[model samples]
Target: MAEGTRRELFTILETSSADADTVPDGGETPVNLSMDVRWFEIPFREPEEDEEQDEEDGERENGCRSAGGAEDTAGGRCDIILVTGNGIKHEEEHPEEERYYSVSYNCSDDSDIDFSDMEEEEHASCFGLDGDSEEEEDCASPHFWGEPDQVISIEPFSVLSGPQHSLGSDADTRDYFRLLFPDSLFEHMVEQTNSYALYRQRRSGKSDPHWHPTDLREMKAYMGLNILMGVNQLPDVDMYWASDIFIGNAGFKKTMTARRFEKLTQNLHLCDRESEPVRGERGYDGLYKIRALLDVTENTMWDSYTPKRCLTIGQGAVAAKGRFCPTQYMPSKPLKKGLRVWMLCDSRSGYCHRARIYVGRASEDATVTALAYRVVTSLVRGLEGKHHHLFMDSFFTSVPLMQRLLRDGLYACGPTEPGRRGYPEVLRPCNVGKLSPGEFYQCQRGNLVATVTRDSKVVSCLSSNSAPGLVGIGPDQEQQGEGDDNWTDTPEEGGVSFGVPRPLPLLLYQENMRGVDLCDQLRDCYPVGRPCKKWWRYFLWFYVNICIVNAYVILRESRGSVPPGGCNGKHFTQRHFRVRLAQQLIGDYQGARGMERAARKRHADSPIEYGHRLERMSERSRRCRNCTNKGLRHESVFGCKICNVHLCRGGCFSEFHK
Candidate 1:
């Protein structure tokens, strides 16, 4: 090894490491080990005359590239290096015999070895120092490296367990509802609400006359009214008890007074306000007001139903127009400004199994990808090792995250951004733009595969659960083909077709990624949300609506099947289920009427004399007010014309005017 000269070496080995101890003594014959011989070319060549002139002028090239640029017409001389293993005898008399070379121990200095002139196929020879004989060829390739005998094996997902409950056709709406809002939860709400009211009274030195300590039954009735309001909505809460004949609902008036409902709504509390940490404190929580409710709801959901194999992780927005620190502004979401919540839901049923409120960033130094990783890991905590296949979006998919999930025995697939770290450079969006529609380029490292496919747009995806290849038309595509002739398997020359081939991972993602969105859709229908100054109230209503949706889902699953028409020959939609649930919650409980109802009645009675007259009614009959007051079960086909009130005919009508 001279200062400026390159030496080309060829190495050979007579025996494998395992067979080294059985080498025979030098006497009889030397083993011809040509098949076991390994070659390595390390060049140590002399520089040209121009280089010597440049060296004299203080402009010398210091790297192997400069030395390799010189011509080598006459083949560089080769030197054979020998490796002698433990218990193996070497004889100097057989100098012409093929020798063993272990480049790992023999290459003492590599500063003088120039590799720039080596051919592409000879790159494998450079990694001889890696010392892995079996994987020697695989190490030569730039994109992949591992044991040569390694195989890709993905574990198949199997359902080891599911929802464990005895709920069957015997379960009613109340039973289903109770699963999510247990009696214990109602009692807890009662205790917290009372304590909060007492704390407020003590701080202000004035007691609220309307605020009486609420009981479990009253809480149930209050929640029932909220659910009813979502079903039969009105602009104002008092309108439910309005004296207007067209607008008022008698059922609401009988269930509870409008004043009592208002009182409960104003004083609702999930936790004691006094126990909350002050703002700017180290242990302060932005969602403290709703923390207890969120925790209980999430735990109940997890216990009520076990999610199926396919699960989706995504973010949903709970609309809140208020001054809150944790509120986020996502312009892309339908609800532009609101609180963001991360949810893990069952893909098939859209039932939410877990939810977490996004209260800003966890710390100042956390990056977006780091926050996403933490959210996913936290949501899927108990689900690990269950062989569940999780689907997510670009926000949560990354090479490292997918690899980490595969290690945990969880399968994951999602659309990934091309620029993410560790993504294969060969399958970058720019590099794969030339692929035809339905065609793709993929690179696999172990079980994780990164694919770039051409669809309407260039899409890049990473998946640990699905193999990399194009799949035939799926069920959804087949349905589309039925409606449009252009969706046929073979398209006409110039016709635009929707039947393009899709990568297996993309197909799975398309089919299962709507779980969170579906949950959001269900929650949005007939929403119980109302305008409130307190931000936590919005979150309260959000969870309440979600509970109803989840309860309905469980009821459907438990029942297994609905009769031909429905339960009792009526189409049982969610609206019907909610109506029944509210009725059960109200039950036979009765509360005293507020003073405002009595005054409104007195006022109405005063206006009765304006132009009172009995008038015949058409269409449906109503319960006669005069007969009901007198404890008679009489129907009315007539009412007072001026007062627009329904009453029994003859004696009953005349007596109402008096």
Candidate 2:
């Protein structure tokens, strides 16, 4: 080798030695193999006098030549070296028989190489640098690394699609939704309403005597009467007496004292458990307890006068403000932090058939369309297939919702958003509002129709069942003269032309959509509800008041149909009805226990145990003044020394005390 090429090779070997020492073992002892194949190459070359000169010329042309650097050695090139850590001298005495040292580089086609049996190490050996020396080798020459194994395959094409059968998919969702809803919704609503009373009865049966109310049923009646009689100005205790025992603002001596009234009302029990702080048990902590009463009352009202045809879905607000209050929008004022109730009522009698409190959206996936559908379906559950017409406001009106109702055999009509799917595009507000007043345009698609009328401004309504029939001249049209620009001049008949000019759909909506409003007006007459920390209490009172209204309506209808000398001979106002009801309820269990005077006397005369006892009075034994007041002078044998009064066992005992 030339002097400069020899120095360059030595310098490369020295740098490789330094790099090998710094390379980490990765916490493992790696097998070290050191081989030099240059000696084999040199030994096989023919010894020629001018061979050294040829090598020197080739080295000068390639700049710095290495085993893998020259393009002539690019194919199948690898330096073949074998240096075992176990010291063993190779028997190289027979060159042709020495298999380990006989290097072979196969440059032929490798179409039949078996790559399956090739280990990762064997593959690495084929392509990796074969020796520590940085020199290019010509594997295409007779002595070099073998060719590598290749792999090739063609894959067939496949199409990807959505699930054919999956849970909660659109195809499976309807049945799942049915499971979430009540099967017999009418019975479910009625059962919820009556659950409280049934629970109270069960609880009272198991409760201790101390937990019993003075009169459970009577106390409920008295509470109802107090609401109708009005006691907003009176103290809580005074309310009890003013509603039942007391007459006007009479002196205390004429009626039950305020202290006695307080004592009676305090013992009222609707549930068995004691107050929470006293017993350390949850006691009526949620709306569950009172909700039953409200629900039952509404159900009873519905049963008494079921709405047969038209019903309206409308919202009613309960004014409440607190962190716990559900946020509900109010069109009349600023955002009201309160609860809303969607009520369905009879169009003619204003009877509330069904109502649901807006607890929140049904779920995270709930949208405006979904909520409206849920409310409408829940309220009109049993009425499906009856072809009952339901009227609603814009908040709940939508094309899909109406289509679903029609599919269920119901007719729905209300003002809906123009952007709602299935709403006719030609009936857009701008397109239809170009007509003069009383001039209307309508578009019908299948069973659904959209009507646009330009009255004060523009009004659009969608109806699944109603049609835009012939327009008739209304009273307003009559007020406008024949020369009015909006009305076309038609031939007058007998100096007058009068025909209904109002759109039929608008007329029907005006008539049928007032059910909810009428129900609200009736409830407003005497709200009987008091401010409560718990929002549901207001609904409880509201349901009770409406029940009374429904009863009044039934009574009026029945009386109006009565012939001369009918059963309902006397007419009574709602207030009179409430007064009579209170009297009857209290009278049923009037004399269950003793009054204040009897208890006081018993305390004062403690040693006189036999002061009062049950004894029958004869016709002439003694004239009891209590009996004389009733036009009966029979002697009242039942007399108490403590109270120092005479009384008949049958009526006077309960009458005087209650």
lDDT of 1 at 106: 24
Give the per-residue lDDT of model 2 (tens digit) for 1-658.
4545332321111123344445332211111112110110101122234534554444433322222221122222222211122211111121232111111121111111111111222212111333332125431223332111121111111212111122222222112212222123223433442444345557667632322233344344345344544422354434434423233333222333444434433332233232323423555344454554544555554455545556788887655544454547777433244568789887766767777777667465258877887888888887766556788888888766775676566777787777665555445654333444544545444345566665565667777544332222333345345554432224342122323234545655766787887877776666564554545556655655666566555554444533223125354555555544444433443323335445453332221111233344443456665777779877655554446567665556545544
Per-residue lDDT for 105 in model 1?
Answer: 18
**Candidate 1 accuracy as TM-score:** 0.68
Q: Write the per-residue lDDT of candidate 1 for residues 1-658, one digit (tens) a residue.
A: 2323222222221234234324332211111121111222312122345534444334222322222211121111111122222211111211242111111112221112111112222122222223355233341244452211112344444554345567766678888777787887789889998898888789899988666788999889888888888899899887887756577777776776667778777778888787789989999978888887877888888988986777899999998877888788888689888889999998878898898888778775267778888889999988777667889989899876775676566878899888877776555654433545655555555556666777788888888665333232222233343345442323343322334556657767887888999999888877885788888888889888888999888877766557212357435778888888888888887776545335453333322222354667657888888888899888877787656778876567757767
The regions of model 2 sitting more than 4 angstroms off are 1-212, 230-287, 318-324, 327-329, 332-338, 430-435, 477-501, 561-572, 588-658
- Estimate candidate 2's alpha-carbon lDDT, on a 0 to 1 scale: 0.45
- Please, what is the TM-score per model? 0.68, 0.50
User: Best candidate per TM-score, number?
Assistant: 1
Q: Predict model 1's lDDT versus the native.
A: 0.63
